[model samples]
Target chain A: EPEVTQTPSHQVTQMGQEVILRCVPISNHLYFYWYRQILGQKVEFLVSFYNNEISEKSEIFDDQFSVERPDGSNFTLKIRSTKLEDSAMYFCASKFNTNTGELFFGEGSRLTVL
Target chain B: AQRVTQPEKLLSVFKGAPVELKCNYSYSGSPELFWYVQYSRQRLQLLLRHISRESIKGFTADLNKGETSFHLKKPFAQEEDSAMYYCALSGQGLTGGGNKLTFGTGTQLKVEL
Candidate 1:
């Protein structure tokens, strides 16, 4: 079966530095999302993307966070000036559309900020 | 606001024993609930959804609107059932903008032989 693929399974970066997490969603998926899980905490939705624009974002997804498809096959989440609080496992999910509501998630990108 | 709650963080059972992972949600409007499972070293995957009213791997969950709960149950547990299970809820509002899901803290099931 085709699964969502995430690049750089693990990322280590310094505080105040920037990091980019990339994901290639299922080829035919039209809606994408980014979620973050702080260690020992429930996963929180960051943002949702559709039609090349952001549809909705949580307060946690502030100026520091941005997502872009950049191309047909790649979806990337960029964190500018990361803080220790940004250290978490980021998961990328995609679905054919919101109505079906079946989300396919990637293996996850573990971001560590020192 | 929508919220999902899983009362237990860890549940252990011996093989052949029955297993239940409790999940409760709070939402005023109509809600959709789903169960997702993730085995060690594997990506998260959907287990079942309440809307389908189907059983997968002998596991089933019933949505009780009166109780605001959707608990997953299996008559017999297997060692392979050991995994992290998360309960999620989505408010499928008009236009699908409420497509985002609220997930529980997750329950780790340890099935021993």
Candidate 2:
């Protein structure tokens, strides 16, 4: 099955540094999303992107975060300033359309901020 | 806000026994429900959706609109069925915006011989 692929399976960064997580969603997908799961916590939605614009975001997805689909196949999430609390497993997902509502997810990028 | 609740955090069953994973939701409008599973060292993947009404790998979930629940059940358990299962809910505002998925904490299923 076609899958969402994310690079840099694991990352370690200092607090206050910036980190970029990359993903290549399924070629035909229209909707893309970013979600994070803090250790032992529920998966929380960070943002959604469509048509080169952000559709919605959560309180945790404040000014420090941004998403871009710079090319037809690459989607990225940039964290401007990382904090220790930012450590978590970040997952990228995409959907072909709303009819199925099934979001295909990547293996996840584990982010660790010291 | 839409919320999904999986009351059991852990479930253990002997091989060949029946198993049921419970899920409940709280949503004011029409809700879309789903079951996702994650095996060790594997990525989370969709198991089934309520709308599809299809059974996958002997696992089936029925959406009881009146009860606001979508419970996943399997008549016979196998060791492979031992994995983490999550229930999720999405409501009317799903098209754009965050299209957030409210996921339950998840239940860990263990099938023993």
Candidate 3:
């Protein structure tokens, strides 16, 4: 089965540095999403994207966060000026349609900010 | 605000024992509930959705609106059933196509031999 794929399985960056987490959703899937889980915390939704634009975002997705579908196959999340609290495993997910609640998830990209 | 709660951080059971992973939600609107599973080194996958009212891999969950809970259960556990289970909730606001999921802290199930 086709699945979502994330790059840089793990990344370590210094505080105040820019970090880009990349994902390639299923080819036919239209909607994409970004979620992150701080160690020992629940997975939190960051942003959702569709039609090449952001559909919704949570408070955690502040000015420091941005998402883009730079191409037909790539969806990327950029975090500017990383912080210690930003260390978490970020997941990318996608689903073919909203009518079906099944969303495919990637293995996740672990980000560690020092 | 929508919230999902999986009380137990870990639930360990022997193979063939009945298993239950509890999940509760706090959502004002009518919500969609789902159970997702993640085995070691694997991606998260949908296990059950309350709307479907079906069982997958011998796992089942029912949405109790009155209790605001959607707990996952299985009749007999197998070693392979061990995994990290997450209960998630989404608001009924399905606009153009982004149903944001709010997940619980998750319950780790270990089906031991």
Best by TM-score: 1
lDDT of candidate model 2 versus the reference: 0.90
- Sort by lDDT, top down from the best: 3, 1, 2
Model 2 over residues A7-92: C-alpha lDDT tens digits?
Answer: 88999999999999999999998888899999998888888888888877778999999999987899999999999999999999
Docking class of 2: medium
Per-residue lDDT tens digits for candidate 1, residues A72-98, read: 999999999999999999999998878
- Candidate 3's error at A36, in angstroms? 0.4
Ranking of candidates on TM-score, top first = 1, 3, 2
Stretches of candidate 3 exceeding 4 Å from the true structure: none
lDDT (Cα, tens digit) per residue for candidate 2, span B12-104: 999999999999999998888999999998888999999999999899999998999999999999999999999988665445543557789
Query: What DockQ does candidate 1 score?
Result: 0.61
Clash count for each candidate, listed in order shown: 0, 0, 0
What TM-score, to 2 decimals, does candidate 2 have? 0.96
Clashing pairs in 2: none
TM-score of each: 0.97, 0.96, 0.96
- Cα lDDT for residue A107, candidate 2: 98
- Model 2, C-alpha of A62: deviation from truth (Å): 0.8
- Per-residue alpha-carbon lDDT of candidate 3 for residues A1-114, written as tens digits (9 for 90 to 100): 798999989999999999999999999998899999998888899999989888889899999999999979999999998999999999999998876658999999999999
